[model samples]
Target chain A: TQLLEQSPQFLSIQEGENLTVYCNSSSVFSSLQWYRQEPGEGPVLLVTVVTGGEVKKLKRLTFQFGDARKDSSLHITAAQPGDTGLYLCAGAGGSEKLVFGKGMKLTVNP
Target chain B: EPEVTQTPSHQVTQMGQEVILRCVPISNHLYFYWYRQILGQKVEFLVSFYNNEISEKSEIFDDQFSVERPDGSNFTLKIRSTKLEDSAMYFCASSVRGGRGTGELFFGEGSRLTVL
Candidate 1:
């Protein structure tokens, strides 16, 4: 079983719609990072949330770290076609390694 | 912006053959790492290197797998003998500092290995 569990493994929405993706884990992490990956490429860093209950925003995207530091969520507003990709959530544990969730594939239709 | 670069974007080899995947991490970065993603799976951490030595490694990184910083600019992963299961996309990432804090990793496009 994956240390991190992501809900709604797949999501499809129309352009301009809003959606939220969740990442949950039983283990506490020092920090959590969200990345978006396109086909035939590597994952790109979206944001890193370190403080519990902290919220950060990037343009139309919003990210929040859980109060317990064991979960996170990513919300995209007015989603566009350019927003379509595989969203991955990874947590950095006590070690240097980053444990990644299975990932949520989001497809925004035009 | 400086980014990690990997070589031999795609490779095809037979089982039992050896393969070497190369990566040039972002300049000025202090940490280097290797991760692999099998099709339709999550990215799995293979190993992390710091100060010229392996700082951490996952169970998937076995005896057959080895990493070397042959020179100052390049980090390479060598698979002594490959198996069909070794086919996957391997990514090389680097960070400015070490630890689980604010250091965000920069990754390359990844090298796809196909073991037949």
Candidate 2:
């Protein structure tokens, strides 16, 4: 099975709508990271959560690490068309290498 | 802000040809990694390097694939024999330290390899 799994392979919502995406894993991780990617570009680091239940806010987005360090969620408050992209969640497992999930493609309409 | 840079931006080659994708990671970063994404596939980790040696590698990084830090600055991934399956976008990333604790990987715009 894929070490990391992201929910809602694709999401589309109107501007100013709130939405949430998820990343899940059966195994524990030292940390989990969230990234955004555009076509032909690499994933850009958005946020990283190390502590269980940790929450961080970036502008209009909120990220939360799971209580068991096995999952994470990203919530956008009033998402904009500019927020549209591929959202990926990566888990840092043993050996300090990261395992990535099939990202969710998010589109925010006008 | 400083960023990772890779080149050539895109490369097209025939099967069995050798191809080297080079990356200059964030200068201050100590850990480097290579990841790839086939069209429509998830980003997959290929390998990680630290202290001039491979720290870890995924199953996809096999005998035909290798990485090197030939100079203090340039880190590269070379495919000894490029197969059609190797066609994908390869990304190079680096972090301040091992795993960066929180895995803050700074990635470069990927190098697209098209094997014909």
Candidate 3:
């Protein structure tokens, strides 16, 4: 079984602060995706990283895939209240199943 | 943007009762999947359906759980006998391709199931 572990399970920061979350795994993945889920709602896709050492940016959020394809990281710059949510990283291999990390709950206070 | 939709946002059933959850995936997508997340737990894959048949399934999908694409637009999951442990939020997802390694999934708002 494949497992993805995320660090900093809970983070509380004031607006304008920056934070980074990490996701690590023992197995290699062909692709990794980041999702943000609000309370009482399903997760919303943030970005998908395919190539090793790839980086993608969406507004204030930046996602990076590790060179070995076994890990990834998400960084938020100048966070705002709207950035508060549960961030999850899912790794996919050849099979259709996606292995997801436990997720990081982030709260940005204004 | 297209999105997956599920009906009866919430359902409550008694143990041993049968329940069916309905989902309408994005119109042009070809692959569909069912996932569940217990309260305070990580999301788990239940099953994946493609070309009108189950392509893959997890150990959690036991004899009581089944999936069907009855028509072009609707996908359904039927639980023959609900158990108290079955209580969770069920999400329906769809992708344009069958390979999760290359495709991104679009998910529904989810159906909350509570088995008493």
Best by DockQ: 1
- Sliding window of 10 residues with minimal summed lDDT for model 1 chain B: B97-106
Candidate 3 per-residue lDDT over residues A1-110, each given as its tens digit:
89999999999999999999999999999999999988767889899999999999999999999999999999999999999999999988889898889899999999
Model 1: per-residue Cα lDDT at residue B3: 93
Where's the lowest-lDDT run of ten residues in candidate 2 chain A?
A91-100
Docking quality of model 3: it rates as: medium
TM-scores of the candidates are 0.98, 0.97, 0.98
lDDT of 2 by residue, A7-88 (tens): 9999999999999999999999898889999988999999989999999999999999999999999999999999999999
Q: How many backbone clashes does candidate 2 have?
A: 0
RMSD of each: 1.1, 1.1, 0.8
Off by over 4 Å in 3: none
Task: Give one digit per residue, the lDDT tens place, for model 3 in B1-116.
Answer: 88999976999999999999999999999999999999999999999999889999999999999999988999999999999999999999999975564758888999999999
Candidate 1, residues B1-116, lDDT tens digits: the string is 89999998999999999999999999899999999999999899999999999999989999999999999999999999999999999999999865455747888999999999
User: Cα deviation in Å at residue B113, candidate 2?
Assistant: 0.4
Mind giving the per-residue lDDT tens digits that candidate 1 earns over A28-109?
A: 8888999999988999999999999999999999999999999999999999999999999998876778889999999999
Location of the lowest summed lDDT over 10 successive residues in candidate 1 chain A: A1-10
Q: Could you tell me how far off, in angstroms, the CA of residue B110 lies in candidate 1 after the best superposition?
A: 0.4
Q: Please, what are the lDDT tens digits per residue for candidate 2 over residues B22-88?
A: 9999999999999999999988889999999999888999999999999999999999999999999
Model 3's interface RMSD? 1.2
Residue A44, candidate 1: how far off, in angstroms?
A: 0.5
Q: Higher DockQ: candidate 2 or 3?
A: 2
lDDT on C-alpha atoms for all candidate structures: 0.93, 0.93, 0.93
What is the Cα root-mean-square deviation between model 1 and the actual structure? 1.1
